[model samples]
Target: MSLSLVHSRALLGLEARPVCVEVHLANGLPSFTLVGLAETEVKEARERVRSAIQNTGLEFPANKRITVNLAPADLPKDSGRFDLPIALGILAASGQLDARKLAGYEFAGELSLGGDLRPVRGALAMSLALAHLANDGAMPRDKPGMPARQPKLVLPEGSAQEAALVPDAEIYRAHHLLDVVRQFLPGDTPPEVLDGWTRIAPIPRREQADYPDLADVKGQAAARRALEIAAAGGHSVLMMGAPGSGKSMLAQRFAGLLPAMTTEEALESAAVASLGGRFALENWAVRPTCAPHHTASAVALVGGGSPPRPGEISLAHRGVLFLDELPEFPRAALEALREPLESGTITISRAAQRAEFPARFQLVAAMNPCPCGYLGSSLRACRCSPDQVSRYQGKLSGPLLDRIDLHVEVGALAADELVNTPPGEASASIRGRVVQARERAIARQGSTNQALEGQAIDAQCQLDDAAAKFLNTAATRLGWSGRSIHRCLKVARTIADLAGAATVQVTHVAEAVQYRRALKAAH
Candidate 1:
């Protein structure tokens, strides 16, 4: 065969688009030609593939004219993930291996000069894309009358493990180029020993998620309660406090109180992490806590680039995004969080490509009460002027603040008070209550309270007469907007769930109202 075709995937944001590696060898002036809208990283794969084939003791078509085309030539291709497929296609076209055997299989891996197959990013995402397409019945058919063949993924060792995490995925792990070559040697005979080549099953980790303990934080019961309510309802929270009031500590331990991730949630979260090249087998099924620095830009939070990679918010999908020193972050960056906080997804549009990433992450943001971080503190006089305090609190827009379901104040503890304060309730105890409340909400409405909207919110968060009157009075007095009232209702609904109540009560409404003081001192 002088022409060979191989299947692979290209990542544009979270979606893994299909790409074809077509290799054609013809008699002409000896040369290597690569064509497609390929990026520099992909063009560099030519040398890597040639070196790998030669080092693996395979014949390289150096004397013959070789042309490799990554088709649909318009799709922009980056990364060395196409290296293995391009190498395989060249060999198959040059009559070194059976081209027919390459059907029904997808290959993606970076090759080292020593013929070793290195792991590539987005392996799990590619596997997930295959599953979605197959289950959605969109896979292309091999013959006119035949149904589409089940796709099998060929990846390097580390990447194979990640791909195997996808359920029922036919994943094969190849350690070296020679191992892959042995599989398609143009014969019906099987190799005596498939040493580096392996087929992995669904590798679901049974290990429990580990997080920073809530007991590490002391003397902030109100703040702790806010965290619990936020976790139970899947609501976003904003915590304002003086410096060293344990706001960051509480935020760090907040993930421990949320319910464990379901397999689907884990896969979505891990898939995004894998796209960011930050995934690990040990971190599987564990909720992520992404704490980007205050200096991070809007692009860093919302995700942007030529290929449009996922940012901190997407990486924190089904998990927590703790923004400490929230006011110190750029206003644009803070504003970028508003859409995802409501829609649970973020869409990034580049010049050539548009992609959306799941960003259903719990936001636990913390900020100082004032510029000096001690507004209304009993421990120290607030050094900043009233104007300074107003400007600092003004950093967060009303829309963004309204999107946050709970706002709580964490008071600074004096020296003697801190010394006398014992360890707070253990995270396991808080998590038990949180998980129960979450289950109750899910059982009642099929989703967390924060996800409820429109008629769903009114239906799920039904309030008693007294609670309704109280909430209305509070909102009227505070001049709350419609969004704020709805968020408060959701928070009250979560409080009711925690109390094992059938409906929101006056007490729940009152507690939820207290959490509405965005910056009580400034107000």
Candidate 2:
């Protein structure tokens, strides 16, 4: 009997855990068996490996017992990512290929029956894991700290660029089973490095969607100001408006006004996309924007399954998660978001493994004031009664509303104003102010105002006596919780930044107070 081992990775949430693929060939009845807690897809790799070996003009060990095992038997393995490593292990065990050259490398890819390599999900995560493992001196080597022993990664040709995103790691691309074998086998000539596969292109910027600019929304300057504050602070916003009031349009433009993602933020966002198999490494850094329908289930919004995966919130990490008709969403889904909203991460636990995904995203939600969409409209009449309106609005629980920092009423636009107003300030102009505000916040607290807490807010958002007096009185009368109060201070800080003010002035406090007026009054 001969045994061979190769290293690979399995994704558990946004992270990749090391998996060892072990293959043994022994004298027994001709059969193949896959063990060690593999899912059905992984167990089915026997036929694929056999066919891939044959297509590569290699001899399949027929009329002999072939057993493949994925170690750490308790942790369930899913997907065909194990195919490449298993095939390589089988070849090594059969003495057809050498396994010594594979020690420092992590292998990942799906094998097609024709021996071609197919891309697997979570290549970025796998690269990140191997990079960390290399850095930690966990990889096997003669010299424990030798950098050459840094875990090299072999990925499907299509995923090589994505894997290359991890700095300081040598990435190899393989198009087929023969390509991988030739690199590790002594008598076989190594395949030439594939052309145009070494360098990964910079992430492409998303094309600007045709959204209504902030300049187009006329009147309700207060609402616009609230939107500006929300954009500047990265705060969750609730816009209660009547029908035809441009609430959706205003919310859509919010993305354009926000600052662009930093390289680190972009990488983190792209990492989440990689796990979901949505990442195109060539254009990997675009911020995610997810707008799930209100009818979305709790699982669809928060992420859950036998092997939990990311949901819309995780997909929208480091970007916008706009929930239009907010109250119309399933209550369970909305409630499930409360944890991530506060913690900036979501942990989904399955029977086998627990996975945590980043959920740091700016939430922009909109809803009508009432069921009739005209609860307080100036131009139209509301047909729903007070009781019915109350019930409709109550769809959004108070706890959920409490987590939102800014709430502004978007009243109906005057007909003449809608027709006559040219686009106001372009998105670029508004984005400049938002960026300035964000920079100021980052300089003071190392994060945006929305992420500030207790002492951090108190230290950075110190209010003048006049502003303090107004805020204290408003807090009492509005029944603001501690979180609401801190959020108000953060909003005030952002407003002050937007105005280029050095202190949290009374006017900034007053504007922040105005944003909470509708929510307080409704309560």
Candidate 3:
């Protein structure tokens, strides 16, 4: 056989698009060439593949003109993930292995000069893409008439295990190029001791995941309540406080107040982590908490690159994104969050292509009340002038503030008060109420209160006559925008859920109103 084809995948955002490696050896001046929109990293695979094959005692087509093309020329190909496939294709084309045996199997891995296979990124994403294709009747058939068998994924040990996490996925782990060669060699007999290759099974972690307990923080009842409400409704929160008021501590423990993840949620979260090359078996089924520093660029907060990758918010999908010292973040970065916060997704558009990443993360942000951190504090005087305070608070635009549903004040606890205060309620107890409230919201509307839209909000949050009048008067007096009023109603609906009330009452409306005014500058 003078021509051979091998299959692989390329990471484009979360979707793993297919790529075909075609190798041809013909009589001409000895040369090596790789084409089809390959980046420098991929073009370098030619050297790695050649070295690996030669080092493994295989015949390299040194005297023949060799050319490799990653088909579908428009798709941008990067990384050394195609190295293994290119090597296999070359060997098969040069008559060293059985080219026909490569059918029904896909390969992805980087190769060392010693022929050792190195893991690639987006293994789980590729596996999930295969599953999606199969379910959607789009998985390509190896041959038109043969009975279909599940596609086998050949990857490095690390990536093989990650791919096996997908249900019903067939994964084979190969430690070296020689291991893969032995499988597809031109023979029906199996190797006597194929120690380097084995099938991997999905290993779902059985143990319960643990997080920081909310009981560690004391004497911030209002802030704790707000965290519970935010967790229940999937609402973003802003905490304003003087220094040493435990805003960060509360935010850190906020994830523990949410319900446990479903299997679907866990798989989606782990798949995203795998795409970012940050997936770990221990972190499986555990909700993530991403806390990027205030100095992070807007591109880092939201995803953007030559080939788009997930940012902090997407990595925190189905989890929490805590931005401590919120006002200290770059204005551009802060503003970039507005769209994703509302839409639960982010679309990054480059000149050549556009990619969308899921970013349905709960936001927990905290900031000092003033530039001096003691504007309304009874313990210490604020040193900044009014203009300084105004400017510092003005860094967060009104539109951005409007997106945050809960704004709570966290006051500093006196020494005596801190010493005398008992351990506050544990997260387990608070999470019980939160989970129940969340269930009520999901049962009634099929989503969290925060996700309710135009007509859905008006239908689910049917305010009684008294509650309607109170909210109307408050909206008019406070000069609230339609968006703000809707947000307040969502919070009220959450409060009603917590109390197990049938409708949003005046008491619920009043409590929800308090949360909207904790930061005076937000007005």
Which regions of candidate 1 deviate over 4 angstroms? 138-149
Model 3 TM-score?
0.97
Steric clash pairs (candidate 3): none
The window of 10 residues in a row where model 2 has the poorest summed lDDT is 196-205
Query: Stretches of candidate 3 above 4 Å error?
Result: 140-149, 191-193, 521-523
RMSD over all Cα atoms, model 2:
2.6
Candidate 2, clashing residue pairs?
215-424
In order, how many clashes per candidate? 0, 1, 0
lDDT of 3 at 57: 99
Q: What is the lDDT of residue 376 in candidate 2?
A: 69
- Compute each candidate's TM-score over C-alphas: 0.97, 0.93, 0.97
lDDT tens readout by residue for model 2, 1-523: 2899999988888778889998999998999999999988898898898999998899899877998889877777899999999999988888887777777677988999999999888888887777777677777776654553667788887777777766665787777888788777745575456552243442344544333467766776767778788889889888888878888788767777877766567778878888777887545555566889999999998888868889999989988899999989998999998999999999998766788999998898888888888876779888898788888888889889888989998888787877886666777788788889888888877988889876888898999999999999999988888878888888899999998888999999988888877744543
Question: Where does model 2 exceed 4 Å of error?
Answer: 136-148, 188-220, 281-283, 520-523
**Better model by TM-score: candidate 1 vs candidate 2:** 1
- Please state the error at residue 23 of candidate 2 in Å: 1.0
lDDT of 1 by residue, 1-523 (tens): 9999999999888878899999999999998899999999999998999999999899999989999999889888999999999999999999999998888799999999988999999999999999988777788877776755569999999999999998888999999999998988898887547879989988857756899999988888899999999989999988988889898889888888988889899999999999999999999999999999999999999999988899999999999999999989999999999899999999998779898999999999998888888888888988898888888888889999989988888888889888988999999999999999989989988999999999998998889899999999999999899999999999999999999999899999999999998575455
